[model samples]
Target: MGKGGKACDASTQNRAAWLHGVNDLRIQPYPLPPLGPTDVRVRMKAVGICGSDVHYLKTMSCGDYKVKEPMVIGHECAGIIEEVGSEITSLVPGDRVALEPGQGCWRCDRCKEGSYNLCPDMEFFATPPIHGSLADQIVHPGNLCFKLPDNVSLEEGAMCEPLSVGVYGCRRAKVGAETTVLIIGAGPIGLVTLLAARAFGAPRIVVADVDDHRLSVAKTLGADQVVKVSFNKEDVASEVEEIKKAMRKGIDVTLDCAGFEKTVSTAFGATRNGGKVCLIGMGHCNMNVPLTPAASREVDVLGVFRYKNTWPQCIEFISSGKIDVKPLITHRFGFSQEEVVEAFETSARGGNAIKVMFNL
Candidate 1:
């Protein structure tokens, strides 16, 4: 709320939305760390609320990570460089960039193998103990910040963070012009996957979800067909048939954006023999599915963690107009205490809200 008169603090002029505990989010002063030799000081411009951010706010946890202490909550963010370290020349002050949140420990074996996303020692922003990029200013590694193209806005630059997941999933599934795709969840991730698959030259893509509005959004986002699905486990067989009919061709790959028992089973039933079922969503950590028959049919189940080396590609995809993330931004709010609470509540009470943004 304090925007004009000596806001934030006398020493630290940065304010952030922090998650203290369950349903306890507050706007408070956040002190920025000194810039490192290879780091750049960035003034944040646009940040998007993610499902994980909502989870950490409402429940104080997402997956095995718990919010035991206060932490700034936002990862999908874009900012303008305010200052650059002496060691950096690739980026300069006044450059707009999208920040890749995760910084892998270069000493890890996974980093050496170029699979940095799997590094156990990754320091991901807004993830548990790691404070995120919701503040007015942040100091991040210059290498992790990719310069946004002239055609890309700050909001679209923020979209690249979540869009990276879809691109990485498609890469794992090997989507191509001859491949047919079926995405089994019309949430934000599912819709992004549909866009990524299309950009990867998928000839056909079908999307299914329990919500009709999300299905409609998927259809409008270039999905060849959208089917209304059910969450009930017993209805999976019938739902699979419906999904098959919607596709009208055997699914070459199934991206199960909803990691539920029912959704995974439906994917197994709908995909053709030798197809790949890529599990991207983390709806349920422990789900029971029929794996024996799927294995017998040569359907391989692939797993993907966070993305690696995908920020530049996502930026290009947006800059080239191959993927349109503007329609996905359903709501926007300013960086104020009251607006922060409302923005988070709007995201948690999801209906038609696909992506929520914050203009700092």
Candidate 2:
């Protein structure tokens, strides 16, 4: 990699990647493009294996979005700046940074209003045609790249992607010092939501998951209470009742990171009157929500797309030691292209893994 006033020999051919179909990913050589004036070239160091990556690998799609053609498959990544564009002033060679994969048209009203995550023309990485950061190097707009503090490692820097989602969820839900928060899934996002809620000063936090291992992780992460749900149970209402009994008087806010019908129902039933439900998971695009009853109780249902303007706060939270994400990284792999594929497979199967990360 080029850095520190020295240029390493450029590869004769760049290593490009493609996802041919479900369960089929291939890496091949291709030509690298020269940096644009507003671009920064980075050598990827660590990329976390996300659930969306697993879904695309196993089914070649996520919800309605499908991988119709070969596409690169990663977005959560941290890297070292190998080259900088002419107009870039805040970064240079050798700077360690985290990449924000979503690129939106700056002319849109959403972008101008600081809600670029909702931009209709946003081109996000690893979401079909748009290439991601799984390869050896990537060229991205300089502004989307976030500089890391001296105390944060590259692996931790990569976690800022998911952490931003948690931060955004908390913001949307308006979790506060007296709020009783219930997180409906104990996956990375759910657990991170718990951490964010705690950092936001929420008084009580309860987490639920079908996986015992994940619940254990949530307990370790300081969840006030943990509920284990059975997927095979015919009546999830009883399970919801049990969780409510443990939490006492239901919760003030519910965050559904599972995105399943059962979990959504549970959230609707368990959330106290006038509470909020934040939907963060993408399990089903169109599931039946208990809107009538929720409305009668004055519940506000909120939806979260990607995060906007949250990376800086997440980075600051991690750097200040208010939130610890090191324990969330349950597994790690080398940066080899093959290892990246394996990590995604393991994450998809969901066995004894919490957060799988790739070290480049």
Candidate 3:
């Protein structure tokens, strides 16, 4: 039994989840299990929708990841602790918290090696067969749930999930004071990457995107230069060349936040010899990059899955005022079950929306 209820039973609880095999999601009653001795019950306050969420909503799948059944579709979330397990010590009821969605089997070598993000036995929320935070409440491990500082809002805490990705990408690319970085996308992730890069002391930051509005937001977020690209442009190579020339000797690191063939090509072309290129977006499964040229130029191509060992640093960054995520949240929704579907729908069709947050 937890603080809010007697015990987990076969009884149904009202929850709003996105069921697959259909295009739209709905609110309905679902069953919740009782909290275990190591689990903490959380009353979900805010959940942010990622681009992956939209992909699931529109296509019901992302690459090889598919939804086989009804699943709650929110991984970026923050909440208040409603109940603590018998064995939990560091957290208790009413504590504002941020959730690290992936729970890896601690006994595995990958988990022991501090790369839990690569743990084969991990179960991540919002992933297929693993229901996520779109519900009213959820049970998670106390260790995976981090306590929020007094100054950080539940919305900023919810944003840590995606921001962690940016931090991980920067860490992988080794971005620093001498790095001249080119970020090839102006979406949420790209913008966050820009912020993280700036925080990492990158000397120059260049951002490109098809959307002018998103590019403007990137500029506001601290991008040194913003380039607007069009799919119909006849000479993308020339435009990229001009941008590179304008950026002075070429970029030390190039990140493809827009995972398309064209953007990948631009990323490869934008980097200097012996530089690094990282692909952070999941727009395309197989991209035909300029591998031969990259090999000749000694360009290091890197990939990022989810982040590991980054939550603590991200939390500290936010707490210390190095990263301000408040402006990233352009829209907010209430915790009422009625607004769940609408919130997902709005996020699924992003235009003016940067980050959509739910308040409980």
**Candidate of highest TM-score:** 1
**TM, every model:** 0.96, 0.94, 0.94
Output the number of the lDDT-best candidate: 1
The lDDT of each candidate is 0.90, 0.84, 0.83
Query: What's the C-alpha lDDT at position 38 in model 1?
Result: 93
User: Is 2 or 3 the stronger prediction by lDDT?
Assistant: 2
Candidate 3 is scored at a TM of: 0.94
Locate the minimum summed-lDDT window of 10 residues in model 2.
1-10
CA-RMSD of model 2:
4.1
Q: How well is each residue in 56-115 modelled by candidate 1, as lDDT tens digits?
A: 988888999888778888999999999988899999999999999999989989999999
Model 3 lDDT at residue 360: 65
Q: Which stretches of candidate 3 lie over 4 Å from their true place?
A: 1-11, 232-234, 336-338
Alpha carbon lDDT at 173, candidate 2: 93
Candidate 2: which stretches are off by over 4 Å? 1-12, 232-234
Q: lDDT per residue, candidate 3, 1-360, as tens digits? A: 121222446347646565555567776655567778888988888889888787888888878888876677779999999898899999989999999999888889999988899998788887776777877888888888999999888888999999998999999999999999999888889988888888899988988888989988998888888888877435568868776965776699988887888888888887899999998987877866678988899999999888987778888889999898888999888755567667767777788889988776
Candidate 1 local Cα displacement, residue 272, angstroms: 0.8
Q: Cα lDDT of model 1 overall?
A: 0.90
lDDT of candidate 2?
Answer: 0.84
The order of the candidates by TM-score, greatest first, is 1, 2, 3
